[model samples]
Target: MTLTLRQPSMLTGMDIPSATQPTPEPAIHVRGLEKSYKDLRVLRGVDLDVARGSIVALLGSNGAGKTTMVRILATLLRADAGTARVNSLDVATRAADVRASISLTGQFAAVDEILTGRENLVLIARLRHLKDPGGIADDLLARFSLTEAGGRRVGTYSGGMRRRLDIAMSLIGNPPVVFLDEPTTGLDPQARLEVWQAVRELAAGGTTVLLTTQYLDEAEQLADRIAILHEGRIVVDGTLGELRRLLPPATVEYVEKQPTLEDVFLTLVGAGTEQGQR
Candidate 1:
């Protein structure tokens, strides 16, 4: 399905020029994007456009080239054919500029277990050459609700805390775009909700997010738009309602309401805070 959208607009409360003016450029733009490995084609003429400050979920089954497409867009891997641009900068010719405009978090958390959570953020901030690395670290620690555990060694941090820290590090430079590849993988339900809130806050703050996930519910919960990758291409791309319309009419049936497994799980787990506090 072709994904068509109106000209991108700045999110509410964003400190930008008046919308009555010209529309801002798309955060991500791809046309006829393709990739391959050793005679095996992974992507075949994929076309996509992600608006500024919106969350777009890329969903697909295993070996569907979701990760491959993400890697190419993140500048970690080059596409074999087609073109991609981030913030209007070409990924192939302006790789550095593209990198400067985006941050990427892979499927697993990437944090230094040997150091304190605070130290890890400070280290990344310093590497980014920020004027106030300590201040930035402190703010991010508080933003992610890690301030209470910031001083503890990362080795002692829970999986949820580590994932939060990893995401915090990615936001050090406040890149306009972020790529999250299965960020909630292996996370408990509570931890997953924490990450989901973080992602929501990012988009609310005018950051464009492109995420890939295997979870359908996750896509429904977090995505403003959803694109399904299949057979080396985006077979379906649209809003959830739009995509649902593509399906055959459902056979409506009235039955007694029953609690789902998720309901039971959430009941047992309790409604933990977004910080993953039990």
Candidate 2:
């Protein structure tokens, strides 16, 4: 199957105000964000800003506190120090309001295996007190391309399909800000691409997305800006092009032609075909 990669063009044709220029308010803002557990500190004086209608990828190794940061921003955990705001509401003081403006999909898929795909979405819509839960569920099912399997139990769905449904459930309330924690961790290449397309669509539709992923290529392809967290702090934050400048210049070299295993395999197959023709 052919896959057409989606480029990040959400910023195209838009006038990007300079850093010195006054700009619109950020969708997410954090300053001196600190979190600690007993003797160990998970986050130490972290600061970040995610613009509205853009995708920001937080890249870090395991245990670098990426999940911890997402939890705090999603109002699922409290910060030992510093402050975080989502949609301009304080995550600490206005936890309820912050939660109302954002949806969080954790590292694992949160779906009822026994329930049908449609049923899972409808349950969430009803929990959110939507007036037309069935209508909302149908719409999301269509959006995620799961309408054909809507009536099937989630246990019958593939890994990619289940992740898609999990993301659809997160959008039940139409929150402006969404947090995705290692969304495509264990997915195969094709499954990863499917999720990447979904994320691109989300950003194109003016939803602010903060995604945490260990996959460097995923970050390069999807994020308008990339932030690397190290040792419980942000070591660098910029666009892919800007980050590339930090590395040494590439050295171009030419090598003599040599027979590779692929070439040998193709040659053997061709020889067998010719001999059979005789």
Instruction: Give the winner by TM-score.
Output: 1
Model 2 per-residue lDDT tens digits across residues 1-278: 11111212221212232345256568889999999989889899999999877999999999999999999999889999998888888999989878877899999989999999999998998887777888888887877778888998989888878898899888776677899999999975556767888898887776789999999989999999999999999999999999999999878889888997746755665422111111
Question: Runs in model 1 with CA error above 4 Å?
Answer: 1-21, 274-278
Instruction: Write one digit per residue (lDDT tens) for candidate 1, span 103-160.
Output: 8999889899999999999998888777778888888888888988888888888778
How does each model score on lDDT? 0.84, 0.82
Decoy 2 TM-score against native: 0.83
What's every prediction's RMSD, in angstroms?
4.8, 9.6
Clashes of 1: 0
Q: After superposition, how far is residue 147 of candidate 2 from its true place, in Å?
A: 0.9
Per-model TM-score, in order, reads 0.90, 0.83
Off by over 4 Å in 2: 1-22, 254-278
Q: Alpha-carbon error at 197 in model 2, in Å?
A: 0.6
Clash list (residue pairs), candidate 2: none
